[model samples]
Target: MNATAKQPISMNISALPGATTREMLADQPMRMTISKLNFWYGPKQTLFDVTLGFAANHITAMIGPSGCGKSTLLRTLNRMYEAVSNARLEGEIQLDGQSILTQDVTQLRRRVGMVFQRPNPFPKSIFDNVAYGPRINGHNQPLAEVVESSLRRAALWEEVKDQLHKSAYELSGGQQQRLCIARALAVEPEVLLLDEPCSALDPISTAKIEELLVQLKELCTIVTVTHNMQQAARVSDFTAFLLTGVMVEYNPTPQLFTTPSDPRTEAYITGRFG
Candidate 1:
């Protein structure tokens, strides 16, 4: 792809009045879909009847105020919520038109990799950290090649190439985050879910990660939960706004940021309230 060429918008899902989620995605090629998803932690419902589609090879960002269900919804995509005691979900989630709920949990995770808010690199060497997933999944690919390819994809290979055997902890915060990303990419997931992946990094690190994400979208779909609206606008092709567990608006990134259809979305983005 030409670096200067604009990416063709696959769907015209602007934030138009009365537009339904199904209508928004009707013509797009979706890598994942969520239908009437309702989730709860014990008796407190956190998500309510949310429906959305993630376009293949595109980045979709979920943005909202604190305590909104952005992270909760992201977790549902890979069944990460299963770790929370008393957590339960109702509704259907599909990847490539197949119900993900019925798939093996282990396999589902492999196909839908996740990175959390903080960079939680393993205590082992940098090389071993990126190689962990492939080893555990029994991938027979050459480990050295996979490590190099994954690091290169994450935009960290050049920085860490000579220090492959160094502990992941030795890297700066930004490098560690990119290393975590390399670990996720090693498995060759079809969808990558990130929850505030840049929250802890400095501006330069954040920019590198943002650039890496743009490049990675050519290989996989990406759904990220970010509190920073600017980051969402800079990196995502689509943006979804959630308020108090309800989907307020979802549209192409430019439209949602500039001319939001919902008053709540407008207020939040304009800094009137969160």
Candidate 2:
């Protein structure tokens, strides 16, 4: 298929009321639908009745205060919370209309790749780092090609092409984060979860990662949990605000930043309160 310029998101809030609480800026397809989601760790609940939908080929950012359960909700989507003992999940999370909880864990994980805040590259060479996923998943593609394409998609190939054989640890922090992204992309997942992927990097590195995310959305849906409000404003198409384990508001990025429906959202965005 030929790639044409995608239509720009409508940011015109001129006539719309300032308190536009409704979501669905456009008739975009849903990549994931989360309904009445509740999560608990042993005895305490971290997420309460969080229901939202992530649009395909777009970036949906989860932003809120430190303990607002942004990461908790992100992890719940992929069932990453299952690792904790006594962890429990309630309600439904569907990918492409099929329940994620019902899917095979390995297969589900392959289709829902994730990159964490810290860059956790393997101790092996860069080539091995990117190839690990495909190798484990029995991907039939040529290892060299997969490695190259994934790195190029991540905006890291040109920087690390000559050093593919070098230890992943030898690269700088930013490069390592990009490498982790390349590693995640190697499996060709349909949805990517990024939990503070840029939190540890310098401004230049963060910018690069943000740029890569925008590019990656052409191939996959993106759900990112970011503490940086400015980062959300710059890169996300949709924004979800959580406060005290409750979903306060979810809307288009422009709407959420400019005229949030809830006063709490406005206050949080404007630095009045977290």
Listing every candidate in turn, what is its Cα RMSD in Å to the true structure after a full C-alpha superposition? 7.6, 8.2
Number of the top candidate by lDDT? Answer: 1
TM-score of each: 0.92, 0.91
lDDT of 2 by residue, 42-130 (tens): 88877777778888999999999998889999998788988888999998999999999988888999999999989999999999999
CA error at residue 122 for candidate 1, angstroms: 0.6
Per-residue lDDT over 185-272 for candidate 1, one digit per residue giving the tens place of the 0 to 100 score? 9999999999999999999999999999999999899999999999999999889998878787788788889878777789999998
Provide the overall lDDT of each model, using Cα atoms, as 2-decimal numbers: 0.89, 0.88
lDDT of 1: 0.89
